[model samples]
Target chain A: MSLVDLSKQVALGIDIGGTNTKFGLVNHRGEILVKGSIPTDEFETPEEFIDALYEKIQPMADEYCEGKEFEGIGVGAPNANYYRGTIEQAPNLPWKGVINFADLMTEKFGKPCKMTNDANAAALGEMMYGAARGMKDFIMITLGTGVGSGIIAGGHLIYGHDGFAGELGHTIVKPGGRKHWSTGSEGSLEAYASATGISITAKKMRAEFPESVLNQYPEEEIDSKTVFECAKQGDPTAIEVFRYTGQKLGEALANFVMFSSPEAILLFGGVIKAGDFILKPAKLHMERNLLPIFRNKVKLVFSELDEADAAILGASALVWEK
Target chain B: MSLVDLSKQVALGIDIGGTNTKFGLVNHRGEILVKGSIPTDEFETPEEFIDALYEKIQPMADEYCEGKEFEGIGVGAPNANYYRGTIEQAPNLPWKGVINFADLMTEKFGKPCKMTNDANAAALGEMMYGAARGMKDFIMITLGTGVGSGIIAGGHLIYGHDGFAGELGHTIVKPGGRKHWSTGSEGSLEAYASATGISITAKKMRAEFPESVLNQYPEEEIDSKTVFECAKQGDPTAIEVFRYTGQKLGEALANFVMFSSPEAILLFGGVIKAGDFILKPAKLHMERNLLPIFRNKVKLVFSELDEADAAILGASALVWEK
Candidate 1:
């Protein structure tokens, strides 16, 4: 393809994780034409990481945008500030301080750049091209290493006064029940419903049920994925872990439903991979807890995007939306 | 005043309580020019009650509107539907079924009419004339016979797909703790933080401490007001009742702060009259529970409107907003 023709259309989508940095050149429709990744933890500073990412992505952008328009870059990162375009005190990221990520991307790529917390990006992506397409009011919850959320009300993402609205994961699901390791707050939903939560459940279950199938694996090896695998094989202990997690999640979602009354709540991330095992229990508890007006009104579904491409597409949707 | 001139400047605001109905003609500045009331329980039907209200309010509206403008009529009632203008299955109201209240008001008064549940009206009132003026995002919580909430996001009340969003009072504050007498849901905030909840707390405290000053009053007479009186006199048990109520309320508000990240949370209704007794503990617990990003950022305050004029003014705000 000719360089002039390649410059006619496309955007750069980037997802920064604690372990990896994934980037892609995507079309307006969210199709990734080219992609690459780098080890994020290897970088000593955000500037070094950006330099490495630019080196890897430039050739792909050059190849894809030779005859197309070069749209802006969109980034999804932990603790990203959409309004300020900085990543602030992200516990998981190797970078220790506030990083002007969007500005750096704009400077390096010679195009406009925007950034939002990963969950918000996922919500925007779903609104544009995933299950939430055409829906004005919905909540996107990412249940990965930790729980994160983005709320859409009246067709707009609710970024309250400090650009930190929609932190549903921290809302108490079981007040005074379990203490969150980091915040030390009792009964935060993240303590009982996230991937880490599943592992914690496994540990507790292991101590209580010594003869269970989960006992076959070393305690450290029994993560959410392992539990899902065991549940698929009909292990009672593993199944119980998901049941407890779903019950907590469902009850929390019911509270959320009553609070915001969203049209739907879309679940995304690693823990959701348990599929029907988690969904069935969640639906049951949510319906059981909801008031008559909200009962059965909210649709709870897993994300529709392919896991590998979801982050890339989610980031790219920001550019398309603008 | 001339009839045409009266028709150009005023609106009628009506508040329908279970025992009595208060009605008034209010000006654009939220001043009540004239007011009247009718016993609600004496009426056999919603139609009859509405008819009696119209009969009482018509004379005052006519007398004051002789040379003024009558913009519209606005009603605040229990279980009101903003979209359909009906009151549905309000447990406290004398009316047994759905009441087409706004439509009936429009037909009887010969003016455009709008209706919303009392809490929502309070939120709109605050937005238009009270503490929330010029604020786009805030939560108005009415701490009355029962807890109620109205959420404003991006400068608009969030009436969800079913016109019944912002039911924060029903959100679970303590999972599996207290059962709501009406909904049968365990741990709902209304079960702990409302005026009735405070009375309930007083009863428990009275039993636990036989020497409590609250025991002087018969169980039936130990309402929130009596408890407040006792608390002001430094009754330990009475003060403890308010402390616990404030703790529950503060914890729930903290969760809400995380979910929506509002700039402030404005409290209204009877229980708020306790002032620093409730505000102190609520602020302490709310700040303690908040995540680092949200900590100390939210302003928690009581509504600034006068109690007598608030309901009427709240209803009148609907007409102006519309």
Candidate 2:
């Protein structure tokens, strides 16, 4: 009834990462109208970073949302707390200490803003627009440089008491097993299931198989992509690397399934590009570990969202969610 | 208002256990006006059990709710599906297959009925009347013959897509370590954290220390209670058993904390009777395994509810919750 067309309304989505910070203006139907990117470490302080983000995004908003209402802002960042609206001690971020990200964004843009961790944002995006549409209970696992997760139960993101829940990446799968590179926690899902972990596995397994295509690359360069390509070329060692990674992932998935009993577990980010090389063994081990009541029930599917746009879309989805 | 006094309403609470079935008429203040129990295995079928339960509880309900309104029925049973209102494939129950427990109760009593697994009922009890009275996010662990768990997040039980959620007991803590006696799952939390697991530890550790008081008891007769008694008498072997059990429990608790950042974790049933011996090490290991953000925040406490009355109280809480 008002002058504004609610359907044409757009949200400003921001994804802050270690290397780069991406922002986009997105419509209600998960369409990105305009987007921009900036190096994350270009600014020394969070204040400077906010100013830079505003400089880029404000002009885009003016051009794209001429007839539409701008529906505030939503941000996804590492170590972000939904309850506190702050990013606390993110190891990868340029800014250290607790950054009052939402308040700062709200202040600069003169609009309300909501923020959550990148993993949780991905879950929101999936719930609203992607594979998890109409699903009430599910887990979104991001298998990137580091493993990350967001658990959705009863159609709500479980932010927990402190809004720091759903750290499945840090949940120990192997007690006293592989030590995490940064956190120092032994046998975390991140140590075995992440892209970094896959690379580590490839490097270790390749040592025993000099004939493998994985040996063609130097130890430092033997990453998940290299392993995937080698596996595609019928390298036994590379195949075994993914198989082992999947086994660890599946074991952790079994633990997660038993915890919340989600309808599905959606895998996201770079590592899933390995396709069935990872999914097959992950599914097999997950089934092997689950109890009879839970076995063969939970769907383990890949994310339908494009990796490049997912972060921005997921961040923007938070605005609509609020 | 009508002639009926809402403040004086009473609920019928039933706890269906493997060995015995207990029922009570509980008031709003969690006071049991009348209570009774019957051997669970005495009846061949669920119908017979229900009829017998009805016969015993009907007169008590009449006496207890003489001037008050009876506020339906709430039941806590093994493998109870809250959404389906059924008990499915409970290994210990005489009722082999899926029994429409809530439906049967409703039809028999001519009133509304709700049902959930016993552990979940315990959590409800804690939320309504015990240690977790004002807590919105917490986990309830019942360490009886077998470990059982009920997770409460945002003040609602996570029933998940299926009714069977919060099965933390069966979650693997020490992957490929100790094998569960019944479920045959290896290194489950129940296999290490339960009273049965404690006895197993006690029996195994007692062999290494022949001079310890634990050796006084026959291997077949050794149980959690026996270990607790010996530990109290300063038997090193018995003390080691509790420490080992606590270590395993603590490690699992750390995993749970990372999954759902609850404010507290309330432990119930027989194993907690070891008190500080179990609690101290459990707290230590849980803290040791946790990431910095999660450390020292989660309270690991014993259930404040009287174990004898907890099941009935918890069951009755379902009515009020609804």
Candidate 3:
């Protein structure tokens, strides 16, 4: 007990998203040996969630069984916290309040489990594998529903006094604005920045231009992707919407640059699918809004992570890191 | 030499402001035995800066001088970096790029020296002695000509890879709305949120309210204090300006909250003198911009610190911490 030996075992990474819950067995090198996903809505209770997850891993565990060489389990969820080992009222998930998620995982499998928010986990995934490789000080912002943030400083995630550090989405781009759900502002960055948020803004623009090429699509079915496609097809309204979205994202990023002063900020998530539309305006606005010293020095780039595997990788990373 | 056990000695804290250079000799509790200030502009060279400083500190040192007990010096200036031990490109101080300020201090007095930007040092000071005492995670924002920020997470200053982690003032609040000399657009929150920035905004409002009480003051001398005074006298224009500044500040703070998720964000410096005029608006906006769960949870308050001795207390803490 005095001098406890360290383990050289690997870990399991789990990424829980809205549509899917993916699982992966990963090594320290960020390699994914086995990976799979289960429809998230299939499981209701916490026990059921773990039981179903265990069922998926059972076959692979039997095939690659090597005693209990696995060290622990790492999970990345929409609203995960390492310190609390729980998910606190994730907007999408049915779970509410503090859930001893690690304890729940441990109760079922008898293994240590660690977890952090998806954004934070994504940051760790990037650090271990994707774009953030070799970076000791960088930040990851998921441009999805809202601008999710994960901070890395001195080669470690900055989980503050509370487990809920690194919530970049809520930062305001336009004060006293209308409304947006994500990033905590009604008319804040999320209102016009995130995909769902941007789509609504685009919907309004589409309303203004009912005769534009964008009018060809049903408003009810029209989402951000349709807007991006229209922009790619040289539709002026869609392009303007992207430009506005990029500008909002860029403005919000400017504030992040000031707070964390990171070397670079990585981007991920679905809405970034608009890629050029998303990045170009963001870059332009970011450059325009940056301090003289910080201008052109900070890098804002998209994340090249595998969307499906990222969560599992991020979740699995939880075990090894803790 | 085997252990090289560093002596647990006291340090000298020096805070050089625009008007004066305050000095303190003390231990780590942020306490001070003897402290005072000397005019800084009176000196010309680095030699003079050191000479004037030592002259003020020598007597105090003699009183508590244990010969080998005094370890080194820690300084906080408008622009400083502990890593490089220099003051690079300071506007307030005539010093240019990379002045080995610590070396100059050590050369003059045979002791080690450390330095950091004033805001960064203030953050350390707050952690060491001020209201954020003993807190492992917190952010200190100094509201002056431009807002300044210093971040501490997990009991350490978040010095990024480039030693420039905290830069709250430059965080982007406005996307592409305005032009500013300080932070430009790179999302400079100071562009629309800082006291000076707010005043500029208020002055612009004069065109609409030609007969408003604010029009009495010349545009150049107008400031947050005057606006606050007007608000107190029931001037709607001043009230609107305060609300506007607070909203901008709150919006910026919401983004910062996500980044660090500190227990509380401690506000200090000049603009805060307007008190609730700023705090009320900021708090409202912060809550609106904050994650619903984090809403009504984060504490936004003023720094309960001594203006005269804070710099000295913080500077001295630099040495005491080591």
lDDT (tens digit, per residue) of candidate 1 on A1-322: 6454432568888999999989888876667889989999999988889899888988887777876787788898988888899999999899888888889888887899988888888898888778998887889999998899988887787877677888888887776778999989888899988999899999899789888888889868989999998999998999999999999999999888887788899999999999988999999999988888789789998888888988888888778764
Give lDDT tens digits, candidate 2, residues B176-213.
Answer: 88999988889999998898898888878878878989
Q: What is the DockQ of candidate 1?
A: 0.61
lDDT of 3 at A182: 36
Question: Which 10 residues in a row give candidate 1 chain A its minimum summed lDDT?
Answer: A1-10
Listed in order, the DockQ scores are 0.61, 0.82, 0.67
Q: Kindly report which residue stretches of model 3 are placed more than 4 angstroms away from their true locations once superposed.
A: A1-8, A62-68, A181-184, A207-212, B1-8, B55-59, B176-188, B191-241, B320-322
**Between candidates 1 and 2, which one is better according to lDDT?**
2
Superposed on all Cα atoms, model 2 deviates from the true structure by an RMSD in Å of 1.9
lDDT of 2 at A261: 96
Docking band of candidate 1? medium
lDDT of 1 by residue, B1-322 (tens): 6344433588888888899888888887777899888998899888898788877888887799887888998888888988899999888888788888888888888899998888888898898889998898899999998899999887888777567888888988877878888889888889988988888888988999998889999878988899989999999998999899999999989988988789999999899888888889999889878898999889997898988878888988888874
Could you give candidate 3's per-residue lDDT for residues A1-322 as a string of tens digits? 4552233356788888777888888777677778788887777776788899998886775565465367778888877777888887777776666677889988887778888888888888888778888888888888776667789987889997778888766656666675664343555666777778887888889889876678898877678888888989999999988998888888777667766667888988889889887799989877776666567878887786788777677777666563
lDDT for residue B19 in candidate 3, whole number 0-100? 72
Q: After superposition, how far is residue A179 of candidate 1 from its true place, in Å?
A: 2.2
Candidate number of the best TM-score:
2
Measured with C-alpha atoms, the lDDT of residue B138 in candidate 1 is 93
What does fnat come to for each candidate?
0.64, 0.75, 0.91
